[model samples]
Target: MTTTTRGTMHPRFDEILTPEAIAFVAKLDSAFAGRRAELLQTRRDRARRISAGENLDFRSDTRHIRADASWSVAAPGPGLRDRRCELISPATRSMGVHALTSGAQVWIADLEDATAPSWENVISAQVNLYDAVRGRLDETREDGSTITAEDSPTTIVVRPRGMHLCEKHISIDSRPISASLLDFGLYFFHNAQALIDGGRGPYFYLPKIESHEEARLWNDIFVMAQEELGIRRGTIRATVLVETITAAFEMDEILYELREHAAGLNAGRWDYIFSYIRTFAHRGDEFVLPDRDHITMTTPFMRAYTQLLVSTCHQRGAYAIGGPAAANPTRQDDEHRHRALALVRAEKEREAAEGFDGSWVAHPAVVQTCQEAYATVLGDNTCQRDFRHGPITAQDLVSLEGVPQTITLGGVRTNVSVALRYLASWVEGTGAVAIENLMEDAATVEISRAQLWQWLHHGSQLAEGPTVTRALLDRVIEEEMAVLTRNAPPERARHFEQARDVLTQTALGDYLPGFFTPYAYVRYLIDRPLRMDGPLSPDDLRQSEQVATPVTNGSAA
Candidate 1:
């Protein structure tokens, strides 16, 4: 099958989007697209069942897989063994430099949620990695002196787009391909050998995976890509993010399926919260989450999830990575800076103290804080297989009845402000931004909007007495928009307007959308397939009026 690129091109994109690479991606897509579709349908069916009051429990069929104690995942591969602290950033040049020089043990070059997945980004990220692999990055400092990027000891991992998305820009026989395959295939095809030759490998961080079946699919791809590329079979390694509520139950099964290729699991806080809301959104108010800000790592149910991850990974002889501190101290004011770092240190200290082999930091600014905590806890930078916390029950996984319902108008306003600002940046081609000094990405937006939708759906009452209604949401949004867009130029203000439309449709519509990215990507990111031979015009950046529904149905509650 021949694959064609429909998106506008940038300089040197041809180097990454070559015919050979396209063919490789097409091959993987052809093999897996049917299974991917079936799995997506299965997700919908399972979600419907749960929404209809069916309960979630560990799969009876996969019980033996978990009960068996003889099996274990392969040990961590090169440059990944001691992941004391890793950096997560968009795969952009500037961010890449900061990540590499941040002194973290691993740099996850995020092409998934942290990236906008613009075709330019798709190509440029590959180009950047292609260069970084060969030690060819050259940049000039502010003082006008050029510095070759450090050949840092940090390992590199790439996160592909999740299964829910497709790379519409690249098509096989006029059909779009899985964004996951496009990302994984292209990166593996181009750089696997180079990485192998350098004693590193084409490592990946799988995202938003809900089942061990998905992990099996990735393992199959790893086998095929390595065979096709003529690399060793076990050369590739992947750390799965147990982000979704469903995935939290299948941690052992997921590892069992990817045992040869599985590196470990990372606790994904925001997406886990988002998934919890979406999975149980239609349930009674008992399940309605409080303000997202209140859902801390120590929250009873959340602690249960993380404890399961740590116990599961250590039991299988794999690394158990923790969530990021995500505090960019550089963005904090002086008074707030000390407080932020203190909070960051405390958070990292808890993760390390809990026997997490390592953790993540969003910005380079907090890498040392993470390292300091881990270094003090894990002097040798390795974990014993003695994770003492476990035996977490299904009720523990699904328990949210105990959390206090502290919904407030302030929480509502915060969600609106965050969703609008983050969506604006995402549609404008950036995926990661610092909001109030914390790293705000697609996952954060998901948590914020999903909580908003859940509160409004359940008619949850705020501490200030009024119930959540469309009128209340609209009023808060209007007040927040004025603050967000004040002193902005026309184009800038219009961007914020488009962002409001996105938030309205995703958060206030009759039902909550599965994700805001796909919603906004179709309405805002897609443009006519015109060549980018010149500068982008106003027509290029504007949202598509064809699908512009503002979702203005009001409620009187």
Candidate 2:
């Protein structure tokens, strides 16, 4: 097929609009069409109620709402996220119940990219994971003491096979299953509904999204599923994987289009990188240019792409989350583990600095790093102050005609004021509040308040508001105080002292020639050639203590 670029929609996609694609588009169109009139009426009614100063649940107030029933606690600081990075892994029949529930915020039991052959395996993995997470069965660890599978603290999110893996077209182990792609999504949606319903959190991650049309299609099916299953609307949310390059351009439109059903957008990096390669397959020299690690995201194109995603989500008031890099993280030693941890830590820090609220983690090890990075960067007290300004007027918070403009940092923005409230909660750790606004979700507001309170009671700072005095920013002065007071974590305390010394020295205006500063080190590393001769060795694997346990190929552990 000849490639043509016409307007915004790529022309190559025109010819490949097969029957499946057409059906997909029709499904989305039908969903919006069916709900359009009702949605408008609901919005009108909601506007009138808000105009009259009535408290409302934003989920119910919308024409359509998406997300599972599980509720999330909002954090301090506008746009601050709980560094609980999601841990996604494909559960195989061989993965013991214990392995599946190991430390992580959310364990995505995947059926799309992880599993190979067997519908039986799919069903088995699902039931096993559900049971494991529910603590119905117990499994022993290497220590001989039984690790009762009680309270698998990690949330279980499932991603059923996509059209690319439909049982009808591609047999699993050469046998056909009773379910198709649509049927599988619906089946799990129904089965998981009872156990996970109601403000707990969603358990679904929609994968391999290629276009806005695809998102629309899923929204339609989701609406139907809710109606048929008697599941409350807005009880289920989807994390759409924006893997294709095109989806990036149409992101804001897609999120706005499915605001009722979307939990947020996920940057599907692996598939996206693969898609990038496929799209420019002709560039063979660059194709073998380097493996993922060798390629620094600071590169011109990558920087633009990453920054674009950050800005786009911020502009629209929705959460702009970074995608997973899928680095192999099975190192067990502190130093090596720190290196792996450092890689992930660096990524999260970069994203946070770039203005992303949070990011995706492929392993359990990176969660602390993500959390710590956010804690260090945003600090406490970001959320305690009053941001609602003036009376909570309709014009200030909500827009009767359209959506609220997102909070902007420089040129970046977010989709809703709730995101701003979330950041506030992250910072102050307690007592931040959001005035009822048309675009603000009541749950979001409540969660933000709760999280802020939790943080203040437990955060690094005092219960009072943050005092960012000139004295506080001076590390040397603080270190001296800490040493005088003999604070805990002596090693860490010493490190701070050393950093303070460096800061003090730098302030002295003594320019030593030929010094390789930290900035220079970073630029040198960024400019260095990517080392992709082979995969990590055993020594490398044992370094990161918190990654998925010992590395294994596709084979069993």
Candidate 3:
């Protein structure tokens, strides 16, 4: 536990880096790494008070804990109330046995932005999520088929890696620890008592939250990791994506700062439209935004941010979910799989008629079209949290009124060819990349390099003419890197030249960096050195099997 710096450990990643999971990730980096560095310097002093123009309300010191009304939250745990969820990739052991047999009640797995944090994908995605939470996951098929999970029932959650990322190949006294407390302290110290004795427990999602004092520092690191793993104290539920525009103006104070480890709230729609273009990129042209394919989720500011996140998770009972139906299903084009299953069944029937209690599908051929569009609006309902639509104010969750500010030249050359082919499949380790058919990830390359730094800091014009300069986004990134070097393949030309130097240092920098995986994880996933047992080529086993299948339309060469 006190081992100050042991960076390269791969051979059986010491069976989930044991020494009591590196002393429960060094006691959650010595009890909350200085309140996670003062909530990341209060997120760089609220982005320099929104670049000095200031204006991001909600928090007259938590407004009597959001006007207290006999608080709620701790409920739906164990195989979390159904709707449908799927987003696999615990660095692929046959895509975590095909996303725990992809029927989809829940299967997140993730390890942040559908993975590629590479320290051998952060210790082989913690040994394939500790063999898929002890059902003893299995895999094989390159055609020789195998895959297991022995009678899978789904529900696994996980996600970890957001408190502005760290795990720089694990260190201690020398610093660098919190990759969200080393992926939720090694999956709640190897699956919290085998997922609460196998009836499902240790669930989570969290990801990029902005405030509610970073969900009260993850509810004081889940009440000091369930009182140092003696378990039973709201076992550990968590959901919280709410994906930033300052956590959509503090969703009920982030469910009243994780009310006993809350379990709901998602709609992390492409990192909440890349945190509303990196928190209004230098305040100009009324928060400029247009093409991330015309900002869908039926845009009037994404239907007032998914109807104020399903009326603040059904007025605080919780479970809202829905975002990410990143269309990936062109199985040999039956008219592009019925127009990507009728655009993911009209975005899962507008998140199952705006009371979302489940949604998210990045292919297992659209998880039964998002479980029959949430079973035709939740038939034997496991959610609608008693249908509360809202008294929704705060200017309907910061209304970027009537939002279709059309800036096009084919949406700035499809945001410089999908942020240079999803940062060349995230510097070749591949953190989700279907591409032209969607499923891009790292929140669609942080909304394609924060919409090319808010269209070159608001000079934005392009509906077929000009403007948008940083010398016209460096001449449309050298004409999309010469059409990705004449259609890729030469072992993916050094990950499209390290994704054109990480999309020209985070889309032509001069401010607005915030993240492109913490400077492309210390430059291209940890500057060289520790290879352990490297050898994966054949284009790193075909970008780790097209990051668990579904890459048809324009195969993202």
Candidate 4:
């Protein structure tokens, strides 16, 4: 074998990680690893410039790409014509079953924020996707029920890990490979042909892209993968996540770069907020965001962003998918459930009115609500590409003045507690957790903690009349840690401590790190072997406590 598997072996995993598959990924690593490193370094360099009083604006050099009017992306690929509702979930066996049956137009098999990059998670997610593509995901459960689709199955679109991460479990000649390449290569190599035969293309939602050149890299990768697999050039379709402020400026260039394989662009609100804070972490209070709850879609800056996304996508003949609706209907209260559904419907109503072709709902219960909202706007139509929104400018995109800075002690406490709980679950190999009727993922953790750092960095005042001090942060974290430590089982108490370690390292540091996932993954989540002979419950996360420590503090990026 040309590659190494540093993780445990099990049934069906070997099928996914065959020698050919590993070799294919190894080739991809050797080819693009240099460029990936250079681009990541470029991000760090750009961040340094932003920190040194440089503001974000449209690139002068890429003006022609935006000014040109004759270009349009390829038509919507198979199964992507009407994406009015897309269900986003991690690729666990059960979750995969539910998502495919949710009656949504698309199911984004997310390997990024919705998943933590544990060895067991990274490999087994591929197994779920493999079984799903082959239509055997639900042969028989131990409970003896067959997985049934309520209607036609949803289209599957995979979102791989960002370029900044590494797949430490599988390596080439003692060197780790890019996690992005591994996820993309394994899926495309194994299932591209099968998907095409089934009348669906190998689709993807690209995440964390910061520039047009980065989009170009993905385009070249798609081209080469198709050629290697003997598929057509434009058979692979991708939707770039316009989540970063930098990418927001270059949306035109990004779509142009991947025009042949481009599906559309999505308004990723959570990560965009995280990026906003991180981009301006070194600045004064002008950029400090209030509580995450207060920063709704109606905020001036967010409206500017969504308006720009819709116009750009329509101008380029691509679908403009909106952000998540952020409500779960599973909570057990008649009044509360009705209220949540009402809010979810209203949110989708606004998106449809603003010309979004589709929107995301985290749970199955809200699917019909989203569908109804879009149905009103797009009756018998697949998308709103014909509808056009008015124009916007660069200053409107970056101006945070209209947002009310109602920072409160409650907000600080909430950030600390939520960050603690979410990080704990993340290390336990459960990426999506339900807390307070909302499903929280890595993006939740990013914005939660980044807001803390940004507020503290500026000494912003809380509504309770005290400045956000390191002492205040330390006290709040300590209190939240005590609550978590008390509630945790004896075997799982260490996870809480580890969670606090990650929080302090990321949120309370002198310099704000670009992302906490890379550092935390390398330090704590790197090579814990799981007894994957059966489906794992939350209790099984502590299967083996013996682990080797990896170097942390932003080195993984």
The numbered model that scores best in lDDT is 4
**Candidate 2: deviation at residue 58, Å?**
30
lDDT of each candidate versus the true structure: 0.84, 0.41, 0.76, 0.85
Q: What tens digits encode model 3's per-residue C-alpha lDDT throughout 478-552?
A: 887897889567868778887888778777877777777766766677637622233222232111112122222
Q: Is candidate 1 or candidate 4 better by lDDT?
A: 4
lDDT of 1 by residue, 440-532 (tens): 789988988888889888888999999998888989999989998899888889889989987887888877778887667656675545323
The global Cα lDDT (0 to 1) of model 4 is 0.85
Backbone clash total, candidate 4: 0
Residue 2 lDDT (model 1): 62
Candidate 2 regions off by >4 Å?
A: 1-83, 92-103, 142-144, 168-190, 196-201, 282-294, 325-329, 332-334, 380-557
> Clashes in model 3: which pairs?
none
TM-score-based ranking, best first?
Answer: 1, 4, 2, 3
RMSD of each: 7.0, 22.3, 22.4, 6.2
Can you write out model 2's per-residue Cα lDDT over 1-557, one digit (the tens) per residue? 11111112232333323344334423322233323323323434543453344532223322232232232212211112242356555564233343345555456666554443232344445455555545564655577866554655555566765432222222222322112243344334434454454224444567655445456655665665566556766555566667655455455556655556565566655455444433332222222222232334554444555665655454444455676635444545676666777777877777666666556665545656766665565565221111111212212211122222221121111111232333222222221122331112112322222222222222213223342233333442444445433654664444344333333322222221111112111221111232113433323211212112222111110
lDDT of 2: 0.41
- Model 1 regions lying over 4 Å from their true place: 530-557
For candidate 2, which ten residues in a row score worst on lDDT? 407-416
C-alpha TM-scores of all predictions: 0.94, 0.50, 0.33, 0.93
